[model samples]
Target: MWKVVVESKNQEQIRHLVFVDGINGRIRLHFDMVETSLRRKVYDNYNNPALGLPGYGPVRVEGGAATGVRDVDLAYEYMGDFYYFFKNNFNRDSYDGRGAELVATVRYCESYDDCPYDNDFWSSTKRQIVLGDGTVTDDCVGHELGHAVTDYTAGLCYFMQSGAINESYSDIWGEFIDLTNGKGNDSSSYRWYLFEDDKYGASRNMANPNIFEQPQRMTDYYYYCGIGDNGGVHINSGVGNKAAYLITDGGYFNGYSVRGLGLTKAAQIYYETLTHLLVSGSDYLDLYHALYQACMNLIGRFGITQNDCENVRYATLATEMNRTSTYCVYPKAPICDVGEPVDIFYDDVEGKEYWKLTPVTMLVLPKYLYSSEYARSGKYSLYGENLDVLSDFAISMKKGVSLPVGSALYFHFEHAYDFESEGSTMYDGGIVEYSIDGGRTWYDAGPMIINNGYDGVIYTGAGNPLSGRYAYTGTSFGFTSSRLNISSLAGRNVKFRFRIGNDEAYADDGWYIDNVRIYMCQVKIVDLTGYWVSVKQTCGRTSRCTIKGKFVVQNTGTSNSSAFKIRFYLSNDTIFSSDDLFLKEYSIKSLKSNTSKAISFNVKLTSGLNAAMRHVIAVVDADNVVNETNENNNLLPSVPFL
Candidate 1:
């Protein structure tokens, strides 16, 4: 028998439908509601009169069949769609992925007059999402549920930059689902707009945020330093929202262009990024790395082409969060499980023993670029200013270190130079040189190559009389030096210098250098394995059962594991490294060489297990705590049952 049930609230009521078994006395399908006003007043005192409406309370309504009520039906339909989106599309079990109940409260108190007297939020404490009557739109419902997905996955923090990413990810989910479901087909209206039916107009527009007074690029970012709105989380989220739009539909912004690969491919990249690459404290640049990692994963997992990867790259590059980037020995370092970097030396002109300044007769102003107070590193930086025609000046650094096999030297430094702009071979620009004999002789390493033109201040020596009517317009902005191969110079005293001069007239802004560092590779090796054992039952009527098992990982390298994280995943299908279902992560603390540890987890089967079909993979050093000789061997799967 089917019946409709109505429940009471403050001066109103909601209705829902369910089926009741005539013989079994069981009820199926329930729509529950809670009056948040009552919960909030009991938990956080009741105050009315001053700013707005009446008190709120909790109520539950159920029915045996369709009630045809608008809000209740809308909530139930939206929730079902959202659940199906995750389960059918991504194989996610539920919000928590373990069958957590979907609890939502409708008719939340509409008292506060600011924006959403009608509002909604996903309460981590309540373990349920809530919606207000005024804010009950399809996209808003999806947006709030997205918070639940993010909570179970990356669990990004709720404040500051991380909070902004959290918000943007939710918005991305809403738009992706709508477009995928064919609800956002209106080209001009709903493509980038969100929450159209709300009391206020669309809260955010992803394609172009300028209409909403939001900053879509890092340069136009709004950083709220005050103690309100959790550091402008909703405001700063436009950066990531715009990135999503560009990734899905391709557009040009801020001097950067991206190719749109459509929403299907874009959603795959974002899902992987949110689930695998992000952590609680990740910021904007971290999102770029996460998206890059996702793009690389798409190449192997989804048969994505190089053009698809480039689209994702340019999409992230438009966000302007690439504010600080370093050219590593391997440009694709972020996409793979890269080796660990071992710092050799770092000097920012704070010390003087390693580097020496050689000035010529006409004078070489080799000192800190700016005053120590204004220097980039809060300390003096290496500065070289030689305006003398035919003058020669250089700053050299000599240091000796043991370089391991297969390790490349990563020389990272920032610089700014403005030299003679006219000639094909302008002699006024600086050249990096390597020397073996202290300072007696040197070989030209290469011209300092600046890939992206400098954006910082370009100083031309206009005040000097020698610089009259001639301002060298050539400027190379701050960038890292090429990966200078120190393999041949390994195990010996290595020296490098920067030299700049001119044939006749010298017009230059001089080179300002700071935050210099050299890095080598460190190696870590880990062996991983997993196994399960089952016991037989005694009687003939017995059904076989399998026991939950554990995976073991060991440090097989010469050095310790150094507190790296190891992951164990279970999959019935083909196990692709990190693309499989994540089971658990364990932190191994300094496992000395030849040491092993085991992690046990829960698993059960109704019948005898075909261990040969099922796979358990252990990923050691999951976060790349230490570089290893073989990145491919980090993942080890259990052998088939014999």
Candidate 2:
């Protein structure tokens, strides 16, 4: 007779048997190790798909004891840890923000030893975690689970900047969970490497992106323009990963110094950014805006302070993601090249070939040919002097040229003119006019004034007049007109005319226009340079060192730098963070043309000394306070100090 013993509700169990055909007796092969408190279920795929595989209440609750299934047990333990991490820290139940049952399938594929695949992933479609044999670790599991979290919120697209941001979020959460789950080195209070052991070493280093040749700043951004790696999603993810590191650890990245807000707050801020702020196709710059907003939200709700918000901006700047800089110069692109020089005064010695002028009365002014003469790169200039009374005088291009469509016509010339103050002259000025028609009805193209000083009389209201040169003064003064955009006459047959007249009240050395030529507008750009930090012992003894450092910044481009920042810190890590022991911030109110400033700062560390190691780091324009031509040289780290 078979024994009939009913089990108690508290001791729920599963029973399975191993048998040999009649020759051998049946033996109990598996039993359940059930924990009612856990809402998670882990299943062994047994080197096969778990779909439609036999008995089911909970796949993990199937015929299995804790002793026999190593992979299943490991998966179950890690899943439970993830659940607690979210529940305890974020005040959430599961990846979906609800008490959803967590499901995982381990030992996936046909055979554990024979299967070629070696990976784990979270399938939002399957709504479950899938793992290959020997591919289980806290980082791995956490990374996959983080994908599930991202799926529930943000729904970030899997390509371009959005995709990179998604990958970075997963890495961040994986590291976060790994560190929180008693799996990282606590002495350092941070672990930058993710999947350190599983991938045969650290798979990615968050502290520095250079380990994998990933760009840390937008200046070095990778543009896998071709189709591959999902637009270099995983490769470019290092940029955002470095951003997370800067936020949590606090340091200088790019040119900005991020304040260390600690992991807990950092996680909260990121959680809010992912859940409430980020959109599907958000790029790096978009992410920067979201993070900046998140920091402000923290300040309004959690009293985080304005400095924290500034840190967020700085961090975003270091990533070269912030597109806002008051000092940045954006030169317009040119659509045409330099055509044949159009000389109106026969100044080129070959000018008569292209010009045929009809004027009422005009005189040729030959500037003193000495090197000291401020002529417009020529020996001759057009001078209009009306000693009698206000008279109509004009100079026009004899031929017309057809401007291509979508192209811009720029007029480049140098001029100097003097004017006399007249009480009755309503507007004392010279005009530059252009005609699409062959000299028919003319349109006043406005002043021919240069800094020889005539512009004030033309611009100053109704009756105010000037008695000085229109632009600069003296025989040495000369003025050059910027590339004047003439896109209006594009696709039209056009010619330019210069007209200057004098009033009856008084006469002065008239308008002298020279070296007039039309060409393309060259793009103007700022080349930010300097911010090199040189260290010297300012005062104090060793161990309690007071080191003074000077940061030098210069404007090497045609454009000027209106503002900039110089950030300095003393720390152990290569990247600057808010959590570093010592740091200082300084700004250049204004840096002008071809000039440099040496900003000095002192670092004093007396207490909580490492006594063994430290690094003095100085970052120029850390916030990318201004657009620059070269960002690679901004960081200067002195030798490690004791």
Candidate 3:
């Protein structure tokens, strides 16, 4: 064919040049070699069609109808095929990515300052590579060129575990494609692309890393000076590289060396994981899950996990981290959500908020309302005095707009405040009674319920006046009777009233109060028909619950609870009880931030004592639990649920 020329150097040095024609410009793909530096071999599919993979693209000629060293500003002409590919694909100046008249001439550059990498390296602008002659190859082309692909196709692969992840990923594809297309060199190992030299050669140990760490030192980010090819992405990817290597070889990190198939298998697995499954920079967990799922997809779960695959890919991820997983655990879902008619109706009352309002009893949403960690997001009010009246009173719900199901509701007595108090001490027979029956009936919340003697000051007594922000006095108080035990009366609408004084000299200082808090808790109970399970739940203690059959451990009474754990054990084991079916040994759980169980576990008691009786005994702490303490802070060891 004749020669097509764009900008030619009329140096009488060389003749017979390969010319590539363009729309407005003509260029020559010079094959400068008297010795002909081209390899002639029968390549299957991976060989470059025009010239072999670039070992060296150009050389200086002295003189000839074919050779003479002329100051030809351009580098060795690229492959006519490659030149055609470029001219056909990227021939545009301002054009995005259509036709390929990309640049007038292809030359070589050594430093980045002279090149415009920053300008269009990642931008959707130009697609050209002026590689140093030493940096040419179909594999290398696809690898480095692949960066432009991702930079063009997807956004910059930013989350590089290392600057090389992109390189690594694309390397896999490039290597495979070259091999697949007969363009790959025999020495090109995906893990070792040793032909090019390992960058993080240390981390590339594949057998061991704690060495060859100069370029691969992922602990820092500067080893790659300005080689912003992968955007310095391959830097932090040793871990992942090793992961890939190990993956190909069955990921058997026995001691150091890897063992298994090779790059082909590894490439297949990783490509599947990355392209279809993984979101780039996915965590190890996600990786493992993806790998597992992908493998299952390719060759059925049973096939992979069973004898079908010899290696039995068990995912070294979790093992590498030394982690243990419990049974199938789902992410905690939103417990509650905002629903229609966000009010609890009493005894089917029609639209009436409060059926019976109490007097001596004050109604104020606890001013000291605690924003529980779980309830801070929304307006989650456990119990608001004015809740029945004010819509502002809210409950924190996992479902943000919804409410938690079977969630215990509770309020904090956080210090105290006067809600409508007068403070007279004659005892106008003021009583604080509670009713579970939709406010229809009222029962004494506790014995501390004062009558014809005490004054109107709850949590307000002797040596202590309410502290700094406290409303009044009595830092503490005890109930002579069950103060407000609604455990036995769960699912019951409740109300409290006062009869302090009708205008008499008895009940003066109206009252000090805090709104009640509601908590919803679900207990997992195992039925001990004739046998038992172990309860390991303790103040961080391991306990077990053994049972004969399946029995439901429902939230017995009220869902709300306060102070430490309030539970009972029903094991077929021996009882620590001294009285009628009571566990002498207390089974308690420690609580973290909330008053809820710190660590709720279970214990196995025995039916040997009363097997036929099915005695489920109560266990309480020495301190104030569901048990009522007298006004003197005296322990009232009564059952939690009155």
Per-prediction tally of clashes: 11, 23, 118
Model 3 over residues 95-210: C-alpha lDDT tens digits? Answer: 22332322211223324464311111212243444333233344444444445544432222343222344545545444443444443344434434422321222123332332
lDDT at 207 for candidate 2?
Answer: 82
Question: Could you give me the TM-score of model 2 versus the true structure?
Answer: 0.44
RMSD of each: 20.3, 28.6, 25.9
Those runs of model 1 whose alpha carbons end farther than 4 Å from true positions after fitting are 1-64, 110-116, 182-187, 221-227, 324-642
Residue 585, candidate 1: Cα error in Å is: 47
Best model number under TM-score: 1
lDDT by residue (tens digit), candidate 2, 210-326:
777776765564423322565567777888888888888899765566788778777877888888887554567668988888878877554566787677677778877754212
Candidate order, lDDT descending: 2, 1, 3
lDDT of the structure predicted as candidate 2: 0.61
TM-score of candidate 3 on Cα atoms, chains taken together: 0.33
Error of 2 at 605 (Å): 54
Q: What is the lDDT of candidate 3?
A: 0.31
